[model samples]
Target: MQPFVDGRYNMSKGRSAEGFDSLLVSITSNTGLTGWGEMAPLGSFYSAAFAAGARAGIVEIAPHLLGEDPRALTRINRLMDTIFRGHPYIKSALDMACSDLTARAAEVPLVTMLGGQENDMADLYKVVTHGSVEEMIANARRIITEGFHRLQVKVGGKVHDDIERVAAVAGSVPKGTVIFCDANAGWTTYQARQFVDATREIDYTLEQPCVSIDDCLSVRRSLNKPMVLDESVTSLEEMLDIHRKGAADGLTLKISRLGGVTKTRQIRDIAVDLGFMITVEDTGGAEVDTAAMAHLSLSTPEERRLHAIAFHQWVTVRTATNAPPVIGSRMGIPDGPGLGIDVDLALLGTPFFETSH
Candidate 1:
């Protein structure tokens, strides 16, 4: 009762080495309005379980979406929300499916429909380079050549390791490059302060460095390093409150987590009005998801000069058997309607299980 895809890619072990057999998800609707999405089920923790749950949620709500206007994404989304409450991950799948389908149906890039004007440029950000000083330096060098002005490194879990990695990567970075750290809720505020102050030279933006949303607010209220909320600021109100409280100077807008593009734009406006910086980011899905995010990025404001979008580079491999949707790290939206992207249904995936249309 699910459409699953598995493929091979050389995943980076710690910026230098590579791992193989990476997997992804491709979701399609019966309307022939198909789309692709990724489920991060292999990242060493809940990624696997999380991805499975998302697939299950899609199965649970598929019947409700059958024959419905995928463009009326909110219709399916509302039903899924009310019918299957408390399954955020599953909601993510359904939301992404709708977005993917909607884009195809309208034949407009997701970014354009999401409200981006012409000539919108999106800058991509890669995962934090992990490993030795040499590896970190190498990875940073690679991304810089790829045209990413900002590099978001992972940290906040191991205080010393974070310091070491950021120190190494920071020094290795070329001049005028922006460096940001994503802790994934791995640090305490006190420790966060020390790390933030230390990495000040790296010009690192604090991203979920503290586990507690309140603590993040505490740090934002107290410090000047500019906290970026990735895990937090889930909804419109959350975005509003964070801005009102002056809690975060920036917010990372992830499509999969926040429902869909319609809602994504609301948060973007809120961020803009509050004078908080906003970057349309990824949920680390495959090319399609990256496309979705890119569309959002192109549609979002460039005043802050905030952009983090790169599709092919982020993934270890391609799932789309076709010429992987023509997209760029700074892909501009071609004039059209809706989330203009197609799912190569022929490459829906090698079947693990059959899902009848």
Candidate 2:
């Protein structure tokens, strides 16, 4: 609905200003309950996924779901995979819709449907978009002033400049505040080590410093700070391997990246069992996406849950009413049935196609 940027976050994946190309889906139950789902690609080049591909895949796979039970989430997911292998983002919306439908059918919230509520709210982290050292420090100051103790600083530029930007922001924030230097897989193994060495005096987290698993593992050996993985972590198998290698101390779990909440929570459970902290979120979407993320984060153990993002706020328009607000430094969640919010279909526009049996 809106093209927005939070500083250098748009640049991390070597993309231009990014826009939300979302596919909103609805699955209606025989009992008259409706569930909504959304899948929005960060950018055409950010990942292996793109909006056009997601829509085309949806068109191909959605008809197969017309006669199936909406509550059979695992079955539905498997059927989609059976019909269309790969392209996890394509099934993300359908999977989300199934979860919403199942929760509504049971008269419970999505979190309760997943299991039960393990938390009510989630700590929020603000992104410090790319800019000069001075500009970045100014942004960090304002973010900290807004009560955000956790910050994800965008780095991965020139090593010297990135070091300067990271050090400046780190020096400005108060002690005990969590600072994560996210390179978004822009750095090489050598660059990752250089940045880590330069910032050894500062206490901050490193995220996906290099693109490859081996590259990240190499970087991991050179530093004592906790490393968080994002781009390289797209599958359960990859997560298990990372755990086996002890490459990540924390993980950035995107619901869309992992397909949907089912696989996302599956990976989350694996992380918790292994004692790795997590940041439950999605690539990007409006209210529906945020609500789904909120419920998932809410159901995660507090200690293991690093923070959840209100991605809708990054969008210029509002898609759902009654979504949790980022007040102070926490995003509040409402305990209501299903997604617990109403979708603005008018803003979403008319559906491209529909079918019923």
Clashing pairs in 2: 7-129, 8-129, 8-130
Global Cα lDDT for candidate 1: 0.61
On the 0 to 100 scale, the lDDT of residue 42 in model 1 is 32
**Could you say which candidate leads in lDDT?**
2
For candidate 1, lDDT tens digit of each residue in 1-357?
121222222122232222212223345656554665544433334122355565566667666665566668667667777887755545654566667667666666565556655355555566544556677688788877766667877675567777888888878888777777777766788877777666666676778777557888876665657678877767787887777676777888776557655567677876777787888754455555555566666666687546665544444455443222334345554334444444454644574433444
lDDT of 2 by residue, 1-357 (tens): 456645324455345555687888898988888998988887776678888898888889988998899888889989999999999999999899888888888888888866678866788998888887888899999998988899999988789989998889988989888998999899889888899998999998899998888899999998989999998889999999899999989998888888987889889888888999988888888888999999989888888888888888887778778876667788866556887878877787778868777
- TM-score of every model versus the real structure: 0.80, 0.96
| TM-score of structure candidate 1 | 0.80
**lDDT agreement of model 2 with the native:** 0.85
